[model samples]
Target: MPGIDRVTLTMITDNYVDMLLPDLPNVTRTGLAHHFDPKTECVQGENGIALHVDVRWGRYRYQALFDTGMSHQVLLHNMKVLGLEADEIDHIVLSHGHPDHYGGLEGLLRHRQAPTPVSAHPDAFAPRYLRLASGQVAPYFNYGLTKEAIRDSGGLLVEHTEPLEIGPGLIASGPIPRVEEFEKAPTDLSAPNALLHIRDGKIEPDIVPDDQALVIQVGDDGIVILAGCSHAGIINTIRYAKQITGRDRVVGVFGGFHLGFPGTPRSKTDKTIEALRELNVEVIAPSHCTGMESIMAIGEAFPDQFMLNVTGSKVTLQAGTQPVVDLDVEARQKIGLQ
Candidate 1:
């Protein structure tokens, strides 16, 4: 359980893109300069989440794609624009069974001729549906993410329900234990009146057991947690990571907190921010399904720790030093593209 020296996370696809955003101490925005080519290449934003994670621990380096965004076009296009190579990714991690999280999987696998390991909870491939308040159940098309499709597209499926090590200092948190009474599944999907899935030919409540997070332990600086859409509350996810890793100090928590989804109570957002504040999370970069209002509220609550994560933005954290934003040149160099 050695810690990593550094870890870099690049947002390949998200719900927002603002090229005018300036670089912060630890956040590099994909500004107009990155699109200086004759064709004026620009990073596209979509209603999905995908992150390129590069971790370095001593002589060992690992690269992973966490979630594949909502479409191959968006995911691949952003990668190209960001100078990240699809073939170089050592693994693929799915946060849940939702389309927005795994939509670009097949396209990414096709792009990489080499078979890659895809880590996820077994429930991620289950047939799921959205249960309306009216009691009608509508099937959710998970964008053709299936066992056959994954296997056909050159993916080596690796399922796990227990915590699994993805790399030197990276841990794939399995099913997060739901302990917080206030942190129920966001009302948008996984709420009791909403989500359902078929199991043994019987429909049952779908809590999105596949929802997980990536925990990166940086030497002394503590752990950085990354999630896709946190169906399992982000607080629960963070607590699970800390409990499992024995790392109480959380450097940051990034990705969709699922607070802004329709029907989700505003109180949940308040509670989430309060819990995060109690944990003393250093950085909070919410994106994707995290509603704008919730994001703004979080920013207001933790102005110093709030980070606006958009497509093509890179957040770099190194041991003993504060997080630094990596410019295009530095990003390319870190991923060995230059």
Candidate 2:
């Protein structure tokens, strides 16, 4: 995929809220207020983020709630409930391989009014685990959504083929080469049999090739990157975004952070923050997997720019103007891990 020319980001999801980010203890707002909902407390609340793409690369890209948030992190339930038609929007760019992000794909397939295509890395079905306080356990990384699944779901399965044009300025990550020395999914996660695997002589190493990102060009607004879990290292993904599409003006970020792994080192978190600051991004909305410590350091480094996302948080992007966002207090009560 080539580098995007430009793009903006629009966050869509549930109404619940919480706090893992330590820096913004004062921050009580997150999640988005829906525009399509009834006259309930939702729409009446502040309007969340809506992105405009006058540029080619930064076009239509939306995430529909594909399942109930019962245990799902990012539910496509709202998207399904609205019965929203799958317009000729750009691409269904996913953040990572977690159940919250991939679970929706199943629902999206069942409800689409027209043909839809999804873009992701080849390792979307690899086995992943989380090291909770109790012990190591499985967290949803085994849904088995493969190339075959895409065909079965009634949508086209487009793998991350470099900074390719999903729709004009919207691009996806290809191979995220980690230049930053500190960042790597420290857990014993494995990738699918997709990419090259080799070792010293026997040529044996677990290939985790499913990690990728959604890079949308917001025209004059710069780039809006949506990450899944960032297991492949956020910096590597950003660097790949810059290299693949030849464009690097990251304005904001959205999706799972995967930072607070039980065994993850403090230095890794600090180094990630350092790289993020060096990236000089405009806005940071760390959600899902982004660990608490990671978010705070970022907020400390770039206060006005770094924030958290929950069920009711929303952000809007306009040309030559500051981004507008709203956090719904009532909606915050409704969020939970599905």
Candidate 3:
């Protein structure tokens, strides 16, 4: 794959940020509410992920949304703050069927009536859940986005169980193969500790067959990997990306690694850090469900390359270049409404 000029990833919606960066160079003490009209609800931080990926190389440019945050309100609100419209997105690729990742589909379609394609794993819509400390398994209320709802939004559902090339050098890992022994879902995550799915009129451990990630080949810079939630272990996800694309150099890995949870064991976190150190990726930006313990461990291991993906952060990556972080904003006056 030829090298791309640059890829800019903007965190449209995420759980946290040390500082609210509505526009770059001018950090704000308050959230977006300070810059935009009060009537227009300000963009909110949430326990979800919605990324705007803009890739540019030579004369070509491609745009995609990795995930739509749990709520349409936050997703849509953040888009407006970023000066982006739903219709402008070239395509949509979902990491899995989790509600927090796919719940905003209906709102996205309502905003952009265009029949843009949405690529996801075949089992993305299967039922899922989270187990409580009391040994009770609560069905994820939001669960998955329905096909009917997607159609209503003029979204073209493209379901696949295998890896696919979505853009010039972008490859979506259809279903990551689990090979790491230490990287497993927590026991309290469920009785069987597996995501549940309904198939053949029966519900069983889900095993999350649909869990995948997007791999971008940036020449010698190796690969830039993005995951919605690495239900399939992050190490496994990275290895699979390399296997499918025949690229061993992993430049960066971002998005949810499923590391941050009460059920997540310290041994596993340590092992993950050990594996990541061996892999020696250039940058590691973990966010959302990537538990604080794991984040701290990874941060300590890769201090120079570690970055926190908070809401309103813009991370830029290019081949043979160190990752750059900045406020995803320009001058407030420039984006101010008349």
Ranking by TM-score: 1, 3, 2
Model 1, clash count? Answer: 0
Q: Tell me the tens digit of each residue's lDDT in model 2 across 1-338.
A: 33344232333442223323221222322223333335533311111221112233346344422112223213333333333334534356554455555655655565556767776665554544443454444353454455566677677777664555656556666557756667744323333211222224332233345666767655554666766667677778777776765656776676655576556667877787778888876777775556656655555555556555654433454334354333322222223211
RMSD of each: 5.6, 7.8, 5.8
Task: Predict model 1's lDDT versus the native.
Answer: 0.84
Per-residue accuracy of model 1 over 219-298 as CA lDDT, tens digit each: 96489999889899999999999998998888878899998777888999999988999998887888888898898788
Error of 2 at 91 (Å): 2.3
- Per-model TM-score, in order, reads 0.91, 0.68, 0.86
Off by over 4 Å in 3: 20-42, 140-144, 186-194, 321-338
| Candidates' C-alpha lDDT | 0.84, 0.50, 0.76
Off by over 4 Å in 2: 1-10, 14-76, 80-90, 126-141, 187-207, 321-338
TM-score of 2: 0.68
Worst lDDT 10-window in candidate 2: 43-52
Candidate number with the higher lDDT (2 or 3): 3
Candidate 3, residues 1-338: lDDT per residue as tens digits? Answer: 67577788888888875443344331222354554656654557888898888888888899999989898888988888767778889888999888779878778888885788899987887766655567677776544488878887788888988988888788878998889988755332355344456766677676677888988888665788998989899999988988988888887898998887565678887888888888877778888888766776677666566665677777677766544443222222222311
